[model samples]
Target: MKTIPTLSLALIGALSLSACQDKTAAPEDIRPVRYAVAGGNAETGGARYAGEIRARNETQLAFRVGGKVVAKLVNSGEHVKKGQPLARLDPSDYQLDLAAKQAQLAAAQSDLAQQQLNLKRYHELLAKQFISQAQVDAQQNGVNAAQAKANQARAVLDASRNQTGYATLTADADGVVSQMQAEPGLVVAAGQPVARLSQDGAREVAIQVPENALEAVRAASSLRVTLWKGGAPLPGKLRELAADADPATRTYPARIALPGDSHGLQLGMTADVALPAQASRQLSLPLTAILDLQGKHYVWVVDDKTLRVSRKAVEVGAIDSDNAAIASGVRAGDKIVTAGVHLLHEQQRVKLLGQ
Candidate 1:
């Protein structure tokens, strides 16, 4: 009787232990996942683009006359004032040309004086009946020819002097020499670029946009420009955009004009521009939260009360690298599974993490 009672107790205990194990194992099938509340308001569409700081006005300075670059007065990156001499040409040739012109003018003036004296003598002779009218007329014509030659030589001399002045390259505006193309001993022609001047004040940024995004970029409501070195964001406005795409880059070039005091900005400094997209306000979610099935997009949204997930169809708009712009079907404040979404099903029981 004692053995029978002990055996019965052991069997009952085993049955009770199995029952407890079954109770604990039943809930293990419910998977735990990380969930985030989709409670953010529709974000303003925006994108970032890389660009470089530039001057609002850039000028290429060159010499007006052709000559050997005998002297480079300013180095690259040197600041210059308006009318400052930037470079000089070999003035030896110009001086010689000027001397020749002056000599021609002087000779012509002397000839004119001689012709006037001859004309006076011929008139006297003609008055005395010593010379023919044709002879006096020839003297008058000689005087006129000498006078015209003198005037022509004088004009040529003036042009030669101007050319001499042009031998010295001067800055047309107050700016910094951003580049130098000619050095000492290099002969450059007239209108050949010798230096690049970046005009002072009113800086801008040069950026390029792809064909697909060019229109949106141009239509941005506002722009914020930030330097790569990091500083307070600077306000910028679109000054102009390229009419056609660049052949090599196939991108439209753009310029953003910066206003106010941009103290720390410098030429050629890399920058980033933020432009708001003109598209309508839309909700954006992580790309991983989206699931594709049979060509349709779906997302796992959880009920706030039951913690059960349901598959909801979503109208996807723009798909960026990391996020998808949801156009419809998913409302704000809905709990969505960002990770491990593919493993979930409709009405599937799930344990919420970070509750």
Candidate 2:
């Protein structure tokens, strides 16, 4: 009777332990992943860059000769017609030089006339046998030498006149004065910029693009310019891009040429240049979402209904802001695992954390 009771207690304890193990087992561990929808951030519409209005042609106005500045006829922001005087140098010195050149020219002409008269008289003397043929030839040579001196003096006088004209700086074309480098009483060298002229023509938008965004800017399919003063955007095209980046900011300088006859466009106005995003299927995601394995790029895409993650290969394109553009192999509205991509496996069931 004691053995039977002891065996029965052991059997009941074993059954109880089995029942507890079946009732209270550890739960299955599922990984929670951070994910983001494609086509978000800077990829939705376009990428914008801060820009400024500018003229297509900016010319540095300078004098052809060095002189002391006597007057500045036009101030910065003033518009002038072609050949309009912008500044003037002291013409007194140039006038004096012109007078001296005139005097020299008169003296040369007098000498030339005297030589011609002497040559004519020598010819008559030689005909009468009063002078040798060699003497007449020598007088002819002296006349030729005097003629050359007169020609040289005439050229010098013409040059002096041109220099006098150069003393007055004038605009070569119709333009607005953008900057003034010379002031009254300032002596400037020849070819030194006296003022900057912004010629009236096609306008352009200038912007600085960061190093990483250069490719996106270059590959932009379409571009538009929006003024900061609130107006409709104007169509634009890429006109210039710097080959190397700036040393201080590490940015590439770019210029977008606008159409001719840009009304309401003013110089130095702030603007925004828009580089439209790629076509409808283009998607962009964070760098963490892209996995590089075996020299290829991949992203973990989650199925909305099942919440199961699968590795999918994607083609990457130019960088747009902080996101990498997906050229192909991805579509809009797909949920991509944005963090801890390395730990994911194919067909892994995942739970998303609140974004």
Candidate 3:
């Protein structure tokens, strides 16, 4: 065989090196990934939340002024009518105050009478030219001043009488006492709640709904309330829903108005609220598909055509052990990585495990 030229050998070596690099570069490393299709969540019968029976209007009865409680007229659970006295504070100080105000009024009235006589005498003297116009004018002004002082004293006396009346705590409306915080010999401050009065009117069931279930509660078609003592469910309607969630419980307070004659549903009684399942057209995913970072949650979504995955932020609600209901983010029919999500990365090539 004839030996190849050195230049030809160099050319063949370069071609082989180029072929090896091309082969390595053309074959990409593809990862196998498992995914599941997201769709609308299933509807259960209803979501049950614990709640309590309450009155439509429950008022806290507090004293308008601070004083030592002298007597408690009503016991807990006692029925009271409008303007009925429930408790009494020591009225000795208030009595003294009223007496002093009356005394001041009397003194003012006496001074006004004397000033009126002086003014009349000055006017007569002016008519006869016995006094100058300036003297008469000054006496008239003094009389006006005395009359103003008398009016002020009368107003103060009326206010003092009102204060004395405040010493007796009376019910503003017909209601039943639910609680009593202060008793005889106990000193209470102004605006301190002495009792809780449940007004005799419409009744309701108070329920605390979690943040995730708040919308469901609001969208509920109907509600059923069952007493904890094992009675038939009573039909209830949504009366009020809190605009904000409680900071500590992260739950919204909702009130369901019960029938006026909801038998056996008394105030402060425990009850169970049942909200029927709501139909939703939003997609849901397994909790394992989501990754929580910082304070937000995200998911790995797959591209159907490209077989690649990208990180997507998602808004989740009402998470259970296996799945989480999606409020926003991924839509219906979107494929999400269900397993080995943490091992995946953004914009990474992937191949379906069963494909």
User: Against the unseen true structure, what C-alpha lDDT does each candidate score?
Assistant: 0.86, 0.89, 0.86
Q: What is candidate 3's lDDT per residue for 176-254, written digit by digit as tens?
A: 8999877999999999999999998888988898887777788887898888988678888888999998899888999
Model 1 ranges off by over 4 Å: 1-33, 37-39, 277-281, 288-315, 319-322, 328-334, 340-355
* Candidate 1's TM-score: 0.76
Positional deviation of residue 342's Cα in model 2 after best superposition, in angstroms: 20
- TM-score order of candidates, top first: 1, 2, 3
**lDDT for residue 262 in candidate 3, whole number 0-100:** 47
lDDT of 1 by residue, 1-355 (tens): 3366888999999999999999887843577888766635356446778999998899988899998998888898888999999889999999999999999999999999999999999999999998899999998999999999999999999999999999999998998899998799998999999899999888999999888877777677679898999888888888899999999999899999998765677889999998864445667788888899999999898887887889999999876556778889888778888889888877998888842
Lowest summed lDDT window (length 10), candidate 3: 38-47
Inter-residue clash pairs, candidate 3: none
- Cα error, residue 148 of model 1, in Å, equals 1.7
Question: Distance from true position, residue 36, model 1, in Å?
Answer: 3.6
The candidate that achieves the highest TM-score relative to the unseen native structure = 1
